[model samples]
Target: MQEKLNQFNLLKKKSEKQVAIGLVIIVVATLLFLTMSSVGSEELGQMLGIIVGLIGGIVALVGAAGFSKVKRTFKTEVLSAFFSEVIPGTDYIPDRGLAPVEVYATEFLKRADRFHSEDLLKGKLDDVDFLSSDVRLEERHVQHTKNGTRVYYVPYFVGRVFRFTFNKEFEGYLQVLEAGSPLTNRDFQKVELESIDFNKKFKTYATTELSAFYVLTPDIMEAIFELEKRNPGRIGLSFAGENLYIAINNNKNTFEIKMFRTIDNAMMEGFKNDLMVIKDFIHTLKLNTKIFKRK
Candidate 1:
């Protein structure tokens, strides 16, 4: 792990140097072009400007490609090392293939017309089954132009979703979305829970009010609130059958390699802490408390 970290740092430093050189070249070219333009040689200045711009552009492209390569290498190595040495028994799959169609049937994800999942981390922790993945869902919007209709794919949701098996089966579906979320269903009416604070932060919708109250005990509500406080992202939750799905609206890729920054122990620790938040969900939510038993 140390060797891999050292290699990543070396590559990062080298990439930074290249980017610095590229920027210097572009700045110098711009200055020269302006100087030539001010000298009143119009044709000559234009020609020189074009030449210098092309050269600078090429150099910048090369630097960007080099940095991109180095970043990819560093991310691959460091993530592998982290999973192996730091969080053993967990496996990371780069491409999680297609997300299940059933996910779109959920209340919060109903807007998703196109879906893709990646960076999947699936494993069992202390007898609890869980799967975490970065999910990107898109919706198609058609615009009628003069020539033809243009189809544009806009992001419906780009975030991390954690799905874990619940200890007991649920008779009906229950969804708790962040306040003012767009997704809604007429079948699932809004449920007002006993906790005013929880109701303020979240809009609960369920097939039945009885099921909603049964599932969202006071302790569970407090745990959810605490989780939201710690992670300030918009959270969407759905409980159905024997599983609970949590979707956190965070667009930033987690555990990614920084191009100009060194991967130090502090950074690694931060990554571990983030992972721990996901890993500790079972304990934090008290999922195995047996509050809801199978019918």
Candidate 2:
């Protein structure tokens, strides 16, 4: 682990230096282009500076892009190694992601204008197939001002999503989204359960009240509560067909290393704990156990 950490840091430092130098060149060139790229009369210095400034900036930006590619490769290498060492029976695939169709099919959270997912983890545990990835859903917003038109993306969900195959198949669809949080404003046909505390913590939506009742049994509700108690994050869940989707809204990215943070045993332990969420969810939810089939 220490050797791998050393390798990660070495490449990170190189990539950072490349990006920093490229940015410095671009900044200097921008100053030249604005202050000295042109003159009232055509002069050698004017033409030469304009050529150096504009062209040099573009070339430097291209170099920055190369560094970004290197960074991506570095991330893949470090993460694959780390996951293999820490988590047994799991395969980390950096480029893959949870299918967008499944994510949208959950319907517990609204679709975003833009979506990004990464750090996919795939494995089977207790004979159940499961996969998860870090997901960020953003809404595109445009504002017209005196300065000009400005566009920005607001993240509606920045967290991790997990999908697991269940033992029983159910035709009805039901969703559980967090409720009563000042930060959320999701409205739907609320399904209230027998547990007042569960109703207070989560808002259930379904094709019908009966479907919600069938899927969110007392044990399921208690499991959801326990899941929250252990994880302590805003969570959304959906049960459809033979699959269960769990979206945890923690506003943190997983498996991605920061260029600045000090990587130590404690940090690695925290990472292992985060990865343990997959195991935790399976065990806490009892996903692998047999369920009564709909008659």
Candidate 3:
């Protein structure tokens, strides 16, 4: 993520420089034109004005070039950031020192292939019985006691959904991950292509905890566009005072998770530690059972 931020910073700095330079050129050209046309000599002043006009035209050209360059650069940065942050199983640090966790879930209402069929759920849940299963999840739920239960409210959706969130310290990592690496766009793309190991990364840092719940019910595609429009890029969805948000990328079939800091520590801690539980709960939904009820 640091790399991405660097890239963005580099591009932003370059843009600022170009703008400054463009303005300077314009100012110089205008000043020269005015000075050359002083009241002393009409012929000389006329020649001076012509020279200044040519210089001013050059300045205009430079200004336009600079402005266009910055515009394109900014656009690339925004798109690159969006993809990096929204992609499932990817974690990044933003420059502001905030750390965010992103989770992605995908579903298919109609089981067309093995990947999206009942067989898929059966295979994954071979060890667990589906005869009777249910749990209560809410803010009042006990912490660290429930084996397969969580206190998050999952969303309603079909196809796939992703969640992404971050703590204050990890902000820089996010900026870097989402923004792209200044060193190389190829490197940034490679990061996006790779898979993520949540446990491994979790152990490396003293991360703040946050939780986000998501639900995908097959016909979720109808809500995908709205989700994208409402949340846009890597930013998390705001639930009440809880900022731990979600990001959904349908094109790549990925989702991102982020936690806002305003949440109480206890709640954040519960969400962070119970990640596996949440995962299990999400996995269980793939089964054909009316037993799973939302609290």
Listed per candidate, the RMSD to the true structure in angstroms reads 3.1, 4.7, 23.1
- Candidate 1: where is the Cα deviation over 4 Å? 95-106, 112-116, 138-156, 288-295
What Cα-based lDDT does every candidate model obtain? 0.76, 0.75, 0.30
Q: Residue 2 error for model 1, in Å?
A: 2.9
Task: Give the Å error, residue 12, model 3.
Answer: 4.1
Pairwise lDDT winner, candidates 1 and 3:
1
Q: What TM-score would each prediction reach against the true structure? A: 0.86, 0.77, 0.26
Better of 2 and 3 by lDDT: 2
lDDT of 3 at 225: 29
User: Top lDDT: which candidate number?
Assistant: 1
Question: How well is each residue in 1-295 modelled by candidate 3, as lDDT tens digits?
Answer: 4565455455545545555565575566566556765655656756665675666566556655654564444334443354333333322221111111112111111111112101001111222221101111112333455476555433222222222211111211111112211121121111221123322221111111221112222222223223334433321222111112232222221111111112233433443332232233323332223244222
Clashes (backbone N, CA, C under 3 Å), per candidate, total 0, 0, 62
Candidate 2: tens digits of C-alpha lDDT, residues 1-295: 6887777666666656665665676576566555653554346446655666666566656655655665577557765777767666789887778878767766666778999888889888877788899889999999999999999999988898999886666666777878843222234456788889988888787767887887777988998988888776788888878888898888898766565565567777787888888888888778777656443
Q: Arrange candidates, best lDDT first.
A: 1, 2, 3
Instruction: By TM-score, rank the candidates, best first.
Output: 1, 2, 3
lDDT of 1 by residue, 157-214 (tens): 7777888887766588999888877766547878999999999999999999998998
